[model samples]
Target: MIRFHLKCDQDHAFESWFQSGEAYDKLAASGMVSCAMCGSTKISKSMMAPAVSTSTSVTPPKPSAAMLAELRKRVESASEYVGSKFVREARDMHDGLVPERPIYGEAKPHEAKKLLEDGIPVLPLPFMPSKKTN
Candidate 1:
């Protein structure tokens, strides 16, 4: 995989990974590449520094367990726990059948995929909803 720094006609910059240089060429030539900001298809590769390895390559610090537990608490406090009716409640809210509100709950993988495919914006919480905790 190769990561390329790209710029659009509007000067919007973004990076993307491709299987290979040939793959990137094929996609770009076919107008598949587009500006991440404005959706313009006029994309071009920008100059990028070569990848290098050094002992000083920084690794991002991991968040502490306390931080995660605090996050879980804050999220639970801010959202309603919908238990397993998550999918129905979320879909209902999306379709305007119910007032839109923050909710968290358990959902099967397939159900989550269906919601995303339908463009109903759902995100996975790092921890299970508190209602389901033992």
Candidate 2:
């Protein structure tokens, strides 16, 4: 298998695994490959440095505090916080009782599975701030 670092036009970076380079080319040419975030068909491999073995020590650069703060702000502003009631609120919205809106919150793994099984759209946030912060 081969792994490619891919980027969409929106600059969302992700990785895709393929059987081979030819397989990737075929899928991409046919528009079968798309960005998970934006559903954009305009995807391409991003340039990446060759991987080194774990035996070779390498230091990864950390994001600046300012950058992290900006990211946290963006996350907070982009979605509504439903807190621990994520599953209930999500179900309500999905059932057309509450108006649908972008939301982020905590849910048990089983709750998430149930949401998926029910065909309700939900995605876990990478980070969740404390309720007091909101």
Candidate 3:
């Protein structure tokens, strides 16, 4: 499947997915494509740059461990560590039961999924090392 950004004569911009470029051309030629916003049939491909892929598929450079550690330290200082009560605190904040503030902690995979399903914003902290227990 291919997606194309389309614009109508009314200058209404929208996107539509097509099976192929030929399919898009056929649809546009037949005036089947219409603007989603203004309902105009005069649709054309909008200006967009093509994504260029490297032939050798060069891997992007990753941040050093020290950089990640420093970032983690900064986040820990800025956000409250709720530990095991992450889900409860997150739910409370989502429901307006608790004052909203920056928080970070541990949560089970299913618990995080449930929160996301419930329309709550939850982001996984990447490159955060586990705390060492005494």
TM-score of each predicted structure versus truth = 0.53, 0.50, 0.51
- Per-residue alpha-carbon lDDT of candidate 2 for residues 91-126, written as tens digits (9 for 90 to 100): 998798998675678899899878867766554444
Q: lDDT, candidate 1, residue 14?
A: 78
Per-residue CA lDDT of model 3 for 1-134, tens digit only, reads 46788888988776666656765786577555666455577888988777677688877456567756666776565568888888999899879999877677888999987887776666566654355321
The predicted structure with the larger lDDT, 1 or 3, is 1
Write the number of the candidate with greater TM-score, choosing between 1 and 2: 1
lDDT values, one for every candidate: 0.75, 0.71, 0.72
* List of clashing residue pairs for candidate 2: none
Q: Give me the displacement of residue 63 in model 3, in angstroms.
A: 2.5
lDDT of 1: 0.75
Flag regions of model 3 displaced more than 4 Å.
1-60, 128-134
RMSD of each: 11.6, 8.5, 15.2
Q: How accurate is candidate 2 locally (lDDT)?
A: 0.71
Candidate 1 lDDT over residue span 4-118, tens digit each? 9999999988777665676577667756565545667789999999988888978745656775676676667657888889999989987999987767898999998788777
lDDT of 3 at 115: 81
Deviation of model 2 at 116, angstroms: 0.9
> Any residue pairs clashing in model 1, and if so which?
none
